[model samples]
Target: MQKGAEAVHAANPDVLVILSGLNFDKDLSFLRQRPINLTFSGKLVFEIHRYSFTDGKSWETGNPNQVCGQVVNDIMSRGGFLLDQGYPLFVSEFGADQRGTNVNDNRYFNCFLGLAAELDFDWALWTLVGSYYLREGVVGLNEVYGVMDWNWCDIRNSSFLKRISTVQSPFQGPGYNESRSHKLIFHPMTGLCVRRISFFQPLELGPCSESDAWDYTPTKTLTLTGTYFCLQADKSGQPAKLGIMCTNSNSKWQAISDSKMHLSSKLQDGTNLCLDVDSKNVVFTNTCKCLSKDKTCDPASQWFKIIDSTRKQNTTKSFFQSKQIAQFLGNTFSYIL
Candidate 1:
């Protein structure tokens, strides 16, 4: 494999040489002992593939949290460790059945997504064609994991795309451009974004690009950029408006759930209210409703996706592999986008 990689590098110094994990490309534990040496600089990348069935030891039968913890550890031991090594690692393939009835796949997918969000790892979904033109001796073979419909006219699953879109753009990473110094609050449901016109103004929905920059502290306080105005809540059932940066409980909010879809808080009345928008497009706290249970529930007004609005043009250090450089290199280094 090294000889082949070296020959490829020799042919084109700028071309990326991809090294897949050993044994069905499931793990790269060997790299911990032996790192690859390419002929060129900044053109080596590692690739790995994963699926719901790969780590199947019964993710459905065990406690989701416990199983998720165990599986995450295993993943870290395998290809996930590459991220810590500061080398670009791509999830060359990962997907679940689009038919959406596989319990193991569904559970494992949630766990996988949680890890993907935290690491901001680049990835590519497993299949793209809903039905194959031909495979083996069979004609018109169906690929349940495909992103497109059987006719290839439209996306097979838009909700899945939207669910995965949260990590589509990175929040924190080595290559984050600091020039913008802003974060946009996004709610995928309505596709409307949260923004502010000025200080002491009510935050409203707008184009995500036009959204205001917000600062989310570890303590869960959201303060507007370059201002003392922090997000706080008024009485329950009322629109949450901007107020002075307060040390009280009203300013506290948190991203709850494994997917971090729910931005919720506890009110003085002890009701667990979530940040939501009514049909009138007003921001307020309401009951923490289920997002995936009912598509007709129309909870877009409640979901908030906080994204980094910075330029991300700069690379932090050698640990940081710029996505642009990876793209410039070649398709050998696989990624979703």
Candidate 2:
């Protein structure tokens, strides 16, 4: 395996040389002893496979959460340790049989997701298409596991996509730290993995005073009247208002009416504050920003900043304060018109 990996590295210096079939057993100390043989400038990713049925009935016994937790811990102990040592851990394959009802699949999925969340690992589902020619006499595949149906014309199981979408989405906020590791959002209904901002924080309407109550809505869009302060506060109680909305345009925030505010700009890179002046409504766009190898941004500003000695030291604390401000403002003035 080492020789093969080294050969690949020698051939393609810029490609990731992945070693697969580490299988389910997971004792990989051999990797440590291997000499650096790569003739390339790429990374090495170690891959593993996991499934609910791997241990037979383990997932079926005991408290679901407890059992699943143990399973995840066991997997991590045996294989996940490699990841902690600066090596990448990839769950190259995982999924439940589609023969069962949505309930069973959902339960299994929850457990899978919980571990994925706890570990923050990268992975790929079993497959994109249905109808695998397994060794067991070409077993008719389950619609649940296949992202698409046998004919490739219909989506066999959309909920699967939805469940994974939350796991794959990049939008990170208060109620969604577990799901933030997701880098993409898949719209099951459309079968498209378009980039999106998942609103992790539940909208808080109580923070707004009685006068501001009109601006709060459970829906994503908000309506408001006149200029209003859009504040964001974090866990520490510090608050920061990105800006006060006076006029709506295609650039800043979208104006639906003289008094309503909706998101016109993308929130994937920054917090989008959408408000309407006439109706006193508001929408918080908690989009997650993807950074390039050379780009870095302040979590508070979601904008890139030049790195300086003094700036780097202060960024962590300041970023925390800014997050607190954004959260507090979201909680406090969500309804304040």
Candidate 3:
């Protein structure tokens, strides 16, 4: 790999060289023992790939929370650790079925988006072409993972596109300094965040760009930044509101379930309620759903990912430059792992 990288540099020194892990670009832990002897510096980037099928039917058979945690831990140990070592890690390939009907793919994607938001790594969608003319003696073979339809005219899933828009911009990294770390209550199902319109208004799900900055305190209270109000639970079907009473049982939220995606809190009536959203995007606290091992139930409305962000509004640098670390080197980062 080092020799190949040197040759590539010898041919074109201006381009960045990316290396992939073994075992089909999924394992890079071997780097801990046998570091690459690359002579080139600043142009070295590592890549990794992940997909729903990579772990078989784990999402279908195991608990979603446990499955998500296990997959994230495995990913970190495999290649995500490079980010901590000051190396640029590229998620070269990662996608799920765009149709959104497959149970396994649907559940896996929810977890995938949450991790992607947290990592904020550079990534490439799995595919673009929806259909091919010929492959293995087939005509017009369809690519279910393609972002576009089979005709390549319209997007296959518009909501899917919106869901990924949050991570398309880097939340925090080098070349950024104005951002103060805060939490954004991201709903993976809708690619939106919990936002408060006003002190007197109820909370609602809106664009992440307009999400209210929040601070999850050590006391389990989710308080709005620069405000004394905490997210308080009301009746079972009532919209969640901002309240000054921070110590009350209704304001203290606990991340329940194995995935820890369910932000559950007690109501004034002692009812255990989870943060949920209605069809109109109104945020509320409802009796928790699918807290057990029920595969048929869809708990998407209740799955909230508290993503950490340090992106301050009104940064002057160009938006493109802040998207990926590789952009700093004046090269478009794209590589297959």
**Predicted candidate 3, C-alpha RMSD:** 11.5
Candidate 2 stretches with Cα past 4 Å from truth are: 21-42, 99-105, 132-135, 138-144, 169-337
Expressed as tens digits, the lDDT of each residue in 199-283 for candidate 2 is: 2332321211111211322332222222243323221212212334423321233322111111234233444433211111122
TM-score of every candidate relative to the true structure: 0.65, 0.48, 0.85
Task: Write the candidate numbers in order of decreasing lDDT.
Answer: 3, 1, 2
Candidate 2 lDDT at 196 equals: 9
lDDT, candidate 3, 20-78, per-residue tens: 98898999999988888876789889999998788999888876776777888899999
How many angstroms is residue 123 displaced in model 1 relative to the true structure, after the best TM-score fit? 2.0
Per-structure clash totals for the candidates? 5, 39, 1
Local distance difference test values of all predictions, in order: 0.68, 0.43, 0.83
- 187-267 per-residue lDDT for model 1 (tens digits): 654455676653334567765445666888788888776656678777667777676545777788887643455677776
Q: Which stretches of candidate 3 lie over 4 Å from their true place?
A: 175-178, 267-271, 313-337
For candidate 1, the 10 contiguous residues with the lowest summed lDDT are 312-321
